[model samples]
Target: MSSRFRLFDRTAVMGSGYIFAMVNRMQMLYYILILPKHLVQPYMIVGILGVGVLSQINLFILAKYLTSNYFVLGYRGFVQLFSEKIVRFFALLGIFFILIKVIVTTLGYVEIVHQFMFPSMKTSWLIFVLMASGFYIASQGMEKTIRLSIISFLATIWVILVYIPYFLPPISEIHHLYPLVPGEVSLHSWYGLLMVWSALSGPEYLVCLGPWIGPKEKILRGMSIGNALSVFEYLVLFVACLLYYGSPYLEKISFPVVNMIRYLQSPVFERVDLILISLNMIYFLYLIALFLLCLYGAIRIVAGRINIKTNRKGFLGSVAAVFICMLIINGWYWREG
Candidate 1:
């Protein structure tokens, strides 16, 4: 292998607790464009922060319990907090959710890449490449996955600066930032408010991460800061979308966040969004690995069947099966389209 080309260093393992928090933030970065349309209003910044408090509530609930509980009991300790049957049942439900999410998210990103990055490429080939990339990261163990998560976060943090154009006028309307109509929040807006909470969904995987962290490191500060940063990023994106397109119009668009990035072709570098989207795959790949690792944990929790540690290939096979299903489902959609 050439020094110029590298995959990942196999020997470099880092603190899982530190990496997990940053990974938490990375997982939710995609939500910046999507959630704003749901929750932001004319009083954009204030509206988002107001809704943000509610969004962070559920995250805080899990963070409060998990960090404290994990510090003392770890996974078994946290698991025993619930009845044996109850914990297993929920873990099974989590398996179902994570399985669907992993498949759908990979398929969705593949479609995005197909549309934006590789218009002429075959979707089948793209799916194959994606699953292969995911499996590569998965085989690295949770330690290495966390390491990649840290490095990817550093690499992609600059993408946030790409939004500077959207924040300025006449692309953005300053008038939209003011309060328009004031009354009791409508049921639809209320429902959208609740949906903002989903932006914080991926952090709960920290519970399964206890084993990955050695006894010396603590996760409380890591999880708390990570959770806080995810919410803050969501708020910034949410408001940015509202500033660009007011609430009513924002809701009509699909993938507002992605489009927000798409709408701005940088004055400095043309079609910067395209380059950013390609760079974003670095973070997305890490997230896919993270999700698969979490799915592996869920399977162990519910079935106690597979030992991912000893049989690395078994874990990779299980992850491959999930991604393959995306292509299987894609056929039905293709036929309909």
Candidate 2:
């Protein structure tokens, strides 16, 4: 394959293909139920919708600028393309940043889980499962993984559509949604919204998307639509949760999104949050796979450039080992009593 084509394939194929498997039955339940805990009712609806919109726009700008600078413009006449040295530098940097973000996020999640669900569950087990899956999916290549993502995304939507009515009855007090903007929005509120903004940014997989689509115009159009839909979905769910659970109660819970669904109970269904947790796991797994792919691909390029392909496996293995160690270290700090 041509160098340009290989790079393009690497970027676009990996993250999205597995989207179907990304969210399993449980994660769909969780994403629908748990994520709304931070915002007030219908207003949270507005907030998250806003978050989705802003995030898409911001990400678009970021992706465009980054791609142009890195690939097209060529920094200071120091071209990075096809140069093993530059690729290795970037790969290492990527691994460092992603490790920091993943470790922190995973630890925070573990802390939340311990405080809420399965207090006795060892944190190490979570780390092990995540790392194991991360290694497997990432090693498998982008094409195979993205197919899973497609199925997972569709399955999640179907499940949510089926459960819509469960949240309808308690969705009273439409008046609570009257004032779109609350009185004297605090600095804390503004800062809190930033986190939501960042969350909507999605993964760096968009970097790969640039090459896969090839034509900038087509890639731009698709990304715009995809980002818009993502924002809409988040907003819709946020509003639904707000209408169902008042802001006062919703704000108190850590994973209010999942708890939102717990209110839904039938004679046949008990503790729907259990199912939601499973879905959340899939989302988390998706992120893990993404990080490892970027890390390993960079490693592969670096190894190939040095003509040390013979030890490529060992180099990639070390990359995983390092991430696993980071997970353990961060997990300890975050999980500490």
Candidate 3:
């Protein structure tokens, strides 16, 4: 909220909290929707693993820095090393960065919903409902947001387990992963693999959590564990995609992971993917709420620089000010796209 420049929740942040934070953040990227397209058939598996290893380096670095003696410096303390002008520049830049990220992610996810679930509904209405939910959660403060994340993580994580059928029988295409020869592995192949590395997002941004983590928590270690879990999750998902859909068909699917889930037939229901996405609604909402908090931090920085201040009662307005940009972007994008 736009109260006093509060740093983090006074409540304790545990190791499990850090793990779930990183897990939810990384999962929030919606990589399962678009990542398979970035990767080609041959080396995609290896690259996803490579992404895991390389991304950890970033996690460790963020962990290394986030371990401040000052009990996890919020953005204010993190910016002290820079001049006032640089601080202003970073604050402004961060605001734009958060705004852009929120806009793009919201629009993209809404489009996916429109494509699969709500083809008959108005996109504007969808955006309104989404932003309203986000505003409510974001205004409540990070404590609720963190709790929602843990709950979302636990709820949606089962979807991963339910995909076990993908590994066997009529689905498995592990044979397509053969031919790891020198001639077959070209530079472009490696480049496509490298592209998967970029899909390994969210961990590098762990530094932003410095203020939110509990005092006694091993922020770095928890983050590292989260990164490991994230990497392993991606690896499993990528391989599953690789084996299930092969090369030619995989590139054709925009949301291959979801598509794969759509085929899942449980004993209780036929279209288990619908249930998956339903429970998964929390993870998506958790993603939006968490990002809103981060955007709040950026807005706080800008407000401070401009000598503009708001009282604790102004938290809702602050949330609105931050999210209005996203609403505009979504409207414009709906028109354009």
Number of the top candidate by lDDT? 3
**Alpha-carbon runs more than 4 Å astray in model 1:** 1-20, 26-29, 43-47, 68-88, 180-184, 214-218, 247-252, 262-269, 306-309, 333-337
C-alpha RMSD of each candidate structure in angstroms = 5.1, 5.7, 3.4
lDDT score at residue 81, model 2, on the 0-100 scale: 51
**What are the per-residue Cα lDDT tens digits for candidate 1 across 236-275?**
6666777898767887877677777767665788776688
Model 2's TM-score against the true structure: 0.74
lDDT of 2 at 66: 40
| lDDT tens digits, residue span 1-337, model 2 | 2222221133343232232133222123223343565455454556666776676666567557544645332222223454656756776676677666566555655555665577798777766666777666655555555545665565455445534753456554565455676777776566557656655544344453233323433444545555665665666666665566567766776665555566667678787666656655665665566556555555555455423332336535755675667665865555442
For every model in order, what is the number of clashing pairs? 1, 30, 0
Per-prediction TM-score:
0.80, 0.74, 0.85
Q: TM-score winner among the candidates?
A: 3
Candidate 2: regions farther than 4 A off: 1-35, 41-45, 62-90, 108-117, 208-216, 299-312, 335-337
Lowest summed lDDT across 10 adjacent residues in model 3 is found at 305-314
Off by over 4 Å in 3: 1-11, 14-16, 181-191, 215-217, 305-324, 331-337
lDDT of 1: 0.65
